[model samples]
Target chain A: MTNSQNNSSVVDPRGPKPRKIMSRRNIILYGTLLVVAIYYLIPLYVMIVTSLKGMPEIRLGNIFSPPVEVTFEPWIKAWAQACTGLNCDGLSRGFWNSVKITIPSVFVSIAIASINGYALANWRFKGANLFFTILIFGAFIPYQIMIYPLVILLRDLGIYTKLPGLILIHSIFGMPILTLLFRNYFTTIPEELFKAARVDGAKFWGIYFRVMMPMSLPIFVVAIIMQVTGIWNDFLFGVIYTKPDTYPMTVQLNNIVNSVQGVKEYNVNMAATLLTGLVPLTVYFVSGKLFVKGITAGAVKG
Target chain B: MNSIEINNLSLNFGDVKVLKDLNLSVNKGEFLVLLGASGCGKSTLLNCIAGLLEINDGQIYINNQNVTWFEPSERGIGMVFQSYALYPQMSVKGNLSFSLKNAKLSKDEIEKRVKHASEILQIESLLDRKPAALSGGQRQRVAIGRALVRDVEVFLFDEPLSNLDAKLRTELRVEIKRLHQKLDNTMIYVTHDQIEAMTLADRIAIMRDGLIQQLDTPKIIYSNPVNKYVAGFIGSPGMNFLKGKILQDGKPIFKLEGGWCESPDLSNYKFQETIKVEKEVWLGIRPESVVVGGEAENMPVNFNLEIEVFEPMGADTLVWSQIGGQEFRFMVDVNTSINVGGTLTVGFDPAHASIFDLESEERL
Candidate 1:
């Protein structure tokens, strides 16, 4: 066909193809993404370098350079015996305590959130929508705000300064966000699914446990990561709600870095902070890949 | 294993009554299709029968028990969803075995059932892959396999083919038909596609405005729609309508006031319901029944009109024209020598035409 007859009026050779134009946008996006990437990396780099350096190098120098004298002493001190108050117990004590609080808390919170999310999205009972709106609003409220009443409530219930109390507090505090995340995720699931599940003779709990929970592994991993990180790095709740014995990694990190002294042990502080962030960070890195794939694959087009 | 009877089922989401006193029944082992446009409550009705939706006032009987409040599992039904909602974390074998696992069946029995279902759907190799690893058609097969493992008395399909590509849709449609035959259980399917309804349904229930307008065999629904809505919904290109005056006599005759076609002979049709109301009456004629024929004396009522557009669809061609400003369509053989802006004589066979009351739009 002739060029004129080719309908150039309807088609421009250089104009974007809906599919092909992504790479151009990706270059611009990735450039900006790189800058943001560096912004996060700088502080992490400072912490790492300071954690490895000797006392003299840590005191006198740029936070970016390699440590003048790298030593494993801070790592050991931070693990076994690091002083928060009178006792010089390092992050290791709180590290175990954090694990104890996080595992059960994340599992309970994520499980409740998934159930709440599915029920709210699929079943419409009396006052169900109002409950959801209230729950979402509750989740958005700054978690620290609840500490005052929660401390008194837990104290009166005679469970304050206990590990179970800390776990309970973590579950209640993390529930709103977990619930919101899960509900938003589940709302995107096709209604045909719930219908089909029921047809398979799945009851409400049956559908939730057998169908929704199984279908939602990626989101569950994400929820676990979020709750673990939030509770693991938690300072205010761990310090106030739990006893010294039940204090999480964040409290120990706080004592290691924030001890009342003129020149703090920057190396130990960095090492302790790194120690505190490991579990949540590890949780994130491990499941982050499948979390993304799960969200897109099982959740979206399905 | 058992028949389903839905009686006066009415459901409302807030003030909008979605299924307004809807009624339909599926005989034992019959593939009943609830066909309607979206929002016409076909899926809603199917959900109600599946015990997924609670009807405000109705009785759903499965094998003679009033199961209005029965739980879905207790009601013994299997439903295939349009989305093929498979559990992501589970292997295909795990997904197929899930319900059986819930039923506390022995592990060996569950394995045996899963193996049987996978072999039937020809998805045996995909047993180890998760739902995320499968394509759309494969996921759908797995979804069907999940339902098959349930081994329930009733099977419900809520637009299961809507998500598939056209070619895959045709392939899966045949697969589903074969499954239905092999399983021989009561299947209640809901779809908006008339072709799907025409091909798969043992009986088609045409729905409109939250009511079952007509529930009959596909042949009866195509040839004898209860009203204009049923007539309009069940055919591709749909039945054409024209305002015509009814001719007086026992044998019903209608004159096309501004139509190119004159009055046709309806000598065979005896208007069963005697009604003198004929002003502005609607005439429903299927495109297949109306055709391009020869001269006037050879045909009783005929139209000689300009062909505005022609669409050749391989097997047959659709010729569109306007008579008295009302658009009309007629089917012609694909090999027919016809061109745009050309005038052709089209004939209407009164034997196949239907008359509708204008105000009510119900077939008389």
Candidate 2:
């Protein structure tokens, strides 16, 4: 607590002395935060560095050290030709598979969840709350517990161990939270708005498409972020549902990096890991602005 | 045919009966204001008329059509909500024209209606701005404009100006009244504010406990409330009541505090035909009706009382004093110089007073 007289810093005209950026308190505060940030970022740094380095340089130097020789060979191999058991093609197969799975899964799950949320918020029928309670409670249970039952059900439908089966699994697992997210967000909307819309001649689907959906873009973006990241990085359901050919990117990435028959090309594995994470990472960065704030700020009179 | 009609309307929220056997009718182009305290079912009744709430037992007819089972839109009505439910993502013009657009109206027709509404509301400049960009009063104007574009037979409002500040509320209140005058549609407005009710309504329905306690013109409801509750509720600084007994004699005098005040001429008063002597009653008088100082000399009943407290309001002053061992409030002109401890003669004429029965509370 340096007094204004003791330091060569500008004193605030409002009387209280403001902390200077170079003050001891700010130094320690920002210094500690920077340390924590770097601590979290160290692994990402290592991944990037490892992905760029040739194997010879990686072996010659420490993992944290700058590479003597950099190469895109590992990235090329990871993207096109890394082997996974009988397959020579690499993470690209799983990449495309994930795109196919994640796109439909995100769209279908959000579409159903937003509509479900709107209905639960505005329209009530017998047993709606009962089923909603069950759905929310279902979110808390471990996904592993339902895997076997889901497998049998998918099998009965003759879609087990297929891409559609994986898509169905993602939607089912994502429902509880997504529905709850949408329902709670939709509830905050003034009930009068719904009434006004109805009096303005909006029907159920009409209100949903015209009123609720446009008004809920922020929540939709949040839901998409959750579903994209959740389904993209999903390893458990992918392994459980789809075979190797149709396996999602995470499953194929895991198989490629952990394959036991060859030498552990560490650089290639890092490259493949970063490649697999690229989709969700891109989504997060692109929507990162709307993700934090201002989506629903002026939507209602505060 | 009446513009809107309700037959045997009853609504229940589970076991709680919110509205009971309510029946009402409105003439075309009449502005009806339902005035009540919170949870008095005034808003519920408006919702029922708007087809927003399902009545457990009732038939609602609009324009001679039994629209009880029809969807709200099909009933040819538009409703404005308390929250000013403008579609946030839409501009003022968009919010006004959304339903028209949804109805697949032609582009020129939709644009024409929107322009007309904007011009009517004096919001022509705010057309391109979103609701979030407009001030609260402007947003409400757009909300009204939304309903105005529909050209419906009936317009329902549920405390549309409650969210604004007091100054803005008064401004919007006058604007809404003007809207009603210009549109000449059957408007059913619900509000807890007596000023809004009194100023805008052609007929005000005062409700309590899910029933319309009194329905009449504002002047009548003010001058002659139907019951003790109606008298107590309709005014600010509400009506003061003094408990006394009416002694039926040669001239029929109201006996209180060993003094006999002349009974009001009741020939025009509507009540039970039977008159009883030694019957207990309560005399109600509005704050403004209680004459003070030199004014009391002209009234039928006059008394000298000490002012307990003097509150100087800007335009007028409210003086509180005790009369017959009961606290009474009376209004005086701001220019009337008065102190808390000063004595002033106060009086009220019986014709301007309401007398209610002690047992039934019905006016006599």
Candidate 3:
């Protein structure tokens, strides 16, 4: 190389140097993170291995060992033939039930809360603050306190022990936080945009549909992630509101895993447990980036 | 006929009166700029005209129709905001055609309007790009196009250039001025920048404390300011004032701390009331009008002052000095060889200087 090129290749004393991969700091940092990863993965490891083992091997008693004799019998049993009370049909019934509850509940809750949030953020009615304050505080109240009252109300509406009753219950409980998430997100939008929409000849519903709804995709994804996980995992409302035949996955999982039957099928229980958690896990993994971004942007601003 | 007229408009937020009994009128195809500092209600007034604000008491007429109680869209006006406010999820073409689609315009009409606007703005290549992919200037052009497609009789701008950098602000400012000329639509613009107001306005309304202080053509407002506030606000390196008193002896002389000079002949000078001796006044003169060096030697009115500093500004030099113990600065041609602490004689026309009553701050 020429003299100038040689000089350029030489390291400058003031500039940062590249770090070695095996540096003491990197070892300590990544070592601590690796330990954490193993700690979290252990239970998942046990679940998969246990579910693959037959009952006789499960009784041989090393829960974390890879199954010596692997079989798909437990998975098939979890899907079709395990008993959850008198109905011998397995989690498929409850899986489909959870699907029915989750879809409408997610859509209905997000639709109502987003519009409610838009109104609260932009349109100021008299005593709106009073009602909003109550709603926000209501989010902290224990669901148990309102359960009995909701049961009476649903009975009056003739949706008691019905899927719609549980859907309504999930939407009602989801309102406060979903509204807060959406309201905070919508307020971050410039006030001038709302005014511009109005000036463009949009009224209340027109602005919501044309302007606010389209710009709010990230927050909607965040809302969907929240509602899906929440409603899918909900056992209290499902147990209280639905008949045994209409039980959601969580309630059915409980009956299948813990019921005092002829014999406790541990492998089938582990497989069923893993199956029930799969929907939320899939949603979380798929929406991981947007979920983080949405929360960061939707964080409350003054 | 007037394109817009507001009479006796007032607005209040609780105890604070943001605008009070304000009245204004815009001739058809007129470009009126509302100029003020922050919180002077310039934007508020524009909002009222656009029907974005509900007035406490007033009548607003647009194109000879009373639109005081009408919705903003029904009032037949379009607006551009400082933030640009393009719908983020939409592409440039979608943003431009969104409102038209809402108004139930036919697809061909929407396409034609969008095409014409993009062509006029030279933003044809940007139609498919999302706002996130566009630069600030491109997003602003799409915003302006959004209003353009509305085809309204009046266009309102609320400090639309404030969010841009200086270079882009100037570029978009010229583009807006060109748009106004080509469309021949009445436009009302709001800005705190005096240069933007002075360059773009056909008639400028200078406001303070929620009131229109003075409304006139840029030349009239600049050359003949009505009061001390107007004189100080219109010019860059704002008008310099030497506190003094009017000496009505012999020939109406103005006496300052260091010395005195002949006051402009006030025989025909319009005064709200008759002038008297010992009346405290502020004598105001713009920096560019202050003559320096050889030009000062033959003046009928002059001051011999010591230069505290001289700034060489390429095109012209700004010389800072003190007169009567108060700081004063004046501009001179760049060729002048002046140094710090040097003495220079400066002159100005008494006719061009303004004398305001110190107590009321109004012109005498």
Candidate 4:
């Protein structure tokens, strides 16, 4: 009993040893991470501080400093009174326009792309490989090259410079990458599951809605985050595709900042930029965990 | 009456033929097992019958109706898969009812069928549990219940118990057998495990290289396999084969190639055709058929050979030895005193052995 007690009392040396709190490796790793984080965070800090300050205070020009007298005037003006073109109304209209474009575009693109992905992954119709190859190839082409042709096509169709036209463009442009993502994700699901669904009397739409759709919530969240951010922050497409009245938030913000006629109120510009960025930020934070889960879901076997 | 029939079925994947000219007829209320190694097209054949694959050429008839062009849902058959393909997002009840709801069955009918299936599968308490929450065996039971709720006339199982542990596999095997006896539906099961095939099947169709080698009752397949491949495949620890030649003396006798012991008599062995003198042949003897100790004294073919290895497997022990310079194995009771390097007398009745032609490998 004494020998057993002595043996039990002795510390085992087989496991990991205790190390200093500030080891060199940890210091290097954490210090590098902290530095990189601050590098990305400092611009966001400046934008927040600048957006809260008045024009005179911003003119003093210490962007790194916190606001001495925090005010909501610039935000209110940015939301209701900033002039983009002839309209003196603010980013609120642009925000609504962005919302309209994003909601429909995200839904429409996801709907079409998910079906296309399901067909490509599960169904073996003729020429499917060719169709998938063409779709994936479209993802690699620069958007700038397609813009002129699309403009001409939309003009001929008589929907040019309209929200519907812009919505159509965003939906079409989002398809190739979104379809590829969904296809790869669907492929990760067991083929037996698809076969079982088929045997269970679920046809194409039935399986898609009931079985595939329910199991694909993570991918849907990922797709929503992707499309919302892409369409909301789009400046080139929004400017070229729609009139100033229907301009998305990104285009309206550009017009407010670089009007080339009035004294550029930097605070109002910063406030408009912050306001324009808020939608995508809110979406990311709301579904951030799901987005990560979606990305890594296909990496491991279920 | 035939419940499922395949006429000249053929499937190709690009340039490679996966299944070639396959024809099968499953009887009503019969349990037929498609047994083969991986890539032998057993699961592929099951898939074809289920209408899950578009066959390159075939006519599949179910319940006297041609279902070659019909959708899987229209074929009146339900299938279970190796992965227990229950909808991971839904509860067991939802999984069982999803297809019924699609079929537009009345709410009361759907509930009644779901209750009946869950009761039969003993998963009534797991109705609200998702597949992810259940253990593997429970999930598989739910999968079977999903198929059962459809009230299909035929059930196809594709290695359904493969994903479970050995103990669970045995338990579920009995459950599946019990389910079949209760349902009395035409069932086509695909498995690589011979023990499962033997125990559960009314008839076993052993396949190799996209062709059916033999389709017979398990006893016939075990005792008189049609080919060398069937003989080699059906038994655990496998049948022992000795390369020899059949010499026609006053009576038929098998001469071992290495001539290590006295030749065994083949007078009592049944031949499929007239035997040729001095023809190359393979003599196959099942390990358990070879008797040891005092039991060997009464046998026609008896020999004493030194044991090289012994594996004690509870009730029986498998002893490996060399006869005629070729490895020979036999099973003895575990209580028997057998050790490596000990000489032991072992013998088998020639009637129980199989003789195969050397070049054709066909039973002779």
Candidate 4 pairs with clashing backbones: none
- Model 4 lDDT, residue A300, Cα: 56
Q: Can you give the DockQ of every candidate in the order shown?
A: 0.52, 0.68, 0.74, 0.80
For candidate 1, lDDT tens digit of each residue in A52-157? 8888887686788998778988888889878877667677788888888888998888878788877777887789889988987996788677778998999898
Candidates sorted on lDDT, descending: 4, 3, 2, 1
Reference-based lDDT, each prediction: 0.82, 0.87, 0.90, 0.92
- lDDT tens per residue, model 3, A190-298: 8998998898878899889888988887899999999999999999899999998789999999999999967889899999999999999999999999999888889
Misplaced by over 4 Å in model 3 are A1-16, A300-302, B257-272
* Model 4, span B74-185: residue lDDT tens: 9999899999988888898999998898899999999999999998999999999888999999999998998899998899999999999999999999999999999999
> Lowest-lDDT window of 10 residues in candidate 2 chain B?
B260-269
TM-score of chain A of each: 0.82, 0.91, 0.93, 0.93
Model 1 ranges with Cα > 4 A deviation: A1-46, A56-67, A78-82, A142-145, A203-206, A242-247, A261-270, A278-281, A287-302, B107-139, B171-183, B247-253, B259-261, B265-268, B275-278, B295-297
Task: For model 4, state the Cα shift of residue B169 in Å.
Answer: 1.3
The backbone clash count of each candidate, in order, is 3, 0, 0, 0
Considering TM-score, where higher is better, how would the candidates rank from best to worst?
4, 3, 2, 1
* Model 4: how far residue A178 lies from native, Å: 0.8
Error of 4 at A225 (Å): 0.7
Q: What TM-scores do the predictions have?
A: 0.85, 0.92, 0.94, 0.96
> Model 2: per-residue lDDT, tens digit, B1-364?
5999999999999999999999999999999999999999999998888888888998999999999998888888988888899988888888898889768899999999998888898999999998889998888888899999998999999999899999999988988888888888999999999999999999999999999999999999998888999999898889988777776566556665434333544333344446688788887889988888888998777878898998888898999987667778999999988987999888777766888988888988
Could you tell me the lDDT of residue B280 within candidate 4? 98
Calculate the i-RMS of every candidate, to one decimal place: 2.0, 1.0, 1.0, 0.8
